[model samples]
Target: MSKIVVIDPGHGGKDPGACANGLKEKDIVLKISKYAKDYLEDGYEGVKVYLTRSTDVFLELSERAKFANNKKADLFVSNHINAGGGTGFESYVYTTINGGTTEKMRSAVHNEVMTVYKGFRDRGKKKANLAVVRETAMEAMLLEHLFIDTKKDADFLKLDDNLKAIAKAEANGIAKALGLKPKTVKKEAPKKEAPKKDIPKKDGKLSKVQVGAFADPKNAEKLAAELKKKGYKPFITKE
Candidate 1:
């Protein structure tokens, strides 16, 4: 069975989760979430990814969780950006679930993100009563990508390549957690060149043909004898 994952980009439309360095959390998280969905679906087999909100539209915290439940998702991941004078990345799961599937998923995803977001501080795996994580039916986690208000972190997030790397990591983590296999790509066979046709000359003349060229006189004589047996007017000329 295919594993279903619902990715929520927190704070859209009227609610911009965080704002810093001339960037809005709503926009950034949406981009990262979309990239993550694309990477997961493209790179892995037996997985289905869906976004809570693909556009800059508003969705209540409860609505996000409900959406995941409606899709019967196996995992729910909410993407967010942090503010308030802090820098680095962190992941959160429901406070009550410990040492279960949720924690395992959280660890898998957290470690994957850390691998890509090198040089960024690791805020450690944590527990929270966040609405999305708490309300989701399946194993769920939330990710605080980086402190948008922090200058250093904000500069890094500004690069599209950096966002793509984060998305790739998230996809890889989910794949690992679900034991999803990589998609097999079929390779095309090489084409063969057509055989050359023997065309007559434009002047209606035939090209010269050499049937046999033997260095030894004995070999030449043997070829002539064989041709004569085949009713070919056999002749041997010495060059």
Candidate 2:
């Protein structure tokens, strides 16, 4: 068969990886993994994609790696968000057998993810005993793209457009590292449909929405408030 990719969105169900101001890392990553799969399928021909869990369910780290090894993946990219106060991004590969932290597979994945997300501070790649990286037989890397609990990283990640951009850039990075070229993402944002003449309004005020109706609404609203505090009027509506 052809070289395939196994994408794992770590954490799920009850194990909500990180929760900050209402955002859940597990759920967010799942969406990103799906976005990446769609991009690869439509843009990169013959590169099959497999996800460990498609729904909001949990998978043990061992099972996560087993999925990739069982599928004989050429690359495995596990998606995750950070917690606590860390800023910027980090990627991990298995600790090398020799003195060095990695071999070629580690270098390729680390270079790809970091190069694509050039704006974020380069935290540098390191050898980690992470389950997903070490256990997977295939070349593998795990990405912690921005912090969900930090004030700065969380703010940046709160926007749907920004999250999509990050995800797409990651897809591009993976493609580049793996020697595939991701097709040019469209430059234009799709025009929004005009609001219906008589759509019903809710709550006589804004009601808290259960996220996924849009991405990162809690953080998104916080950012909007910050923007307004700096003299910009921002609006919040479901997408």
Candidate 3:
């Protein structure tokens, strides 16, 4: 069965979760979420990814969770950007869940993001009563990418490539956690051979031998005579 994954871009439209250094959490999370969805679908097989909101639109926390539940999602990943004075990456699961699939997924995702976003502070896997994570029916996790208010973190988040890296990391983590297989490309069919042209024939036989092309008729005749002596049926043709 195809595993269904719901990616929630934390804030949008009127609610820009956090804003700092001219960056809005709503926009950044949306980009990250879209990239993650693309990476997961393009790289893995038997997985269907859905986004709570694909555009800049507001969605209540309860609505996001309900959307995932409606889709019967196997995993719910809520993407967010931090704005606290501190800088780093962190992941959160529901405060009540422990030592289960949610925790395992949180570990996988956190480690993968930390691995890709190297040199950044590892804020560690944590638990929170965040609405999206807490309200979701399936295993859910919220990722705090980095502090938008922190100068260094915001600068890093400003890069499009960095966002893509983060998304790819999250996709990798999900694939690992779910044991999803990479997509296998089907081999192309062998091309058909071109039709063969009829070989030039002299009378009813194939013309296999070519005689000499000489500037002088005498020279051509001499070569043809030699070819005849050698048992080759040679005929001289003038250009």
Residue 108 deviation, candidate 1, in Å?
0.6
| Model 2 per-residue lDDT tens digits across residues 1-239 | 45598889889988999999678998889988888887777786457889999999978999999888889988888989988787778877777734332355556555655654556677877668898888988778888887898876777777777667666766666666567755556895556743333334674543333322337678778877776666544667775
Span of 10 residues, lowest total lDDT, candidate 2: 205-214
Reference-based lDDT, residue 27, model 2: 80
Q: Highest TM-score: which candidate? A: 1
- lDDT per residue, candidate 1, 1-239, as tens digits? 89999999999999988898999999999999999999999999999999999999999999999999999999999999999998899999998987988889889999999998788899999998889999999999999999999999999899999999999999999998998999877784445643323446999775545569889989989998887676555567779
Q: Which ten residues in a row have the lowest lDDT in candidate 1?
A: 189-198
Scored by CA lDDT, what does every candidate get? Answer: 0.91, 0.75, 0.90
Query: Listing every candidate in turn, what is its Cα RMSD in Å to the true structure after a full C-alpha superposition?
Result: 9.9, 19.0, 11.2
Candidate 3 residue pairs that clash? none
Measured by lDDT, the strongest candidate is: 1
Candidate 3, 165-203: lDDT as tens digits = 999999999998898998876785545743333356667
Stretches of candidate 2 off by over 4 Å are 97-112, 115-119, 181-239
Off by over 4 Å in 3: 185-239
Clashing residue pairs in candidate 1 are none
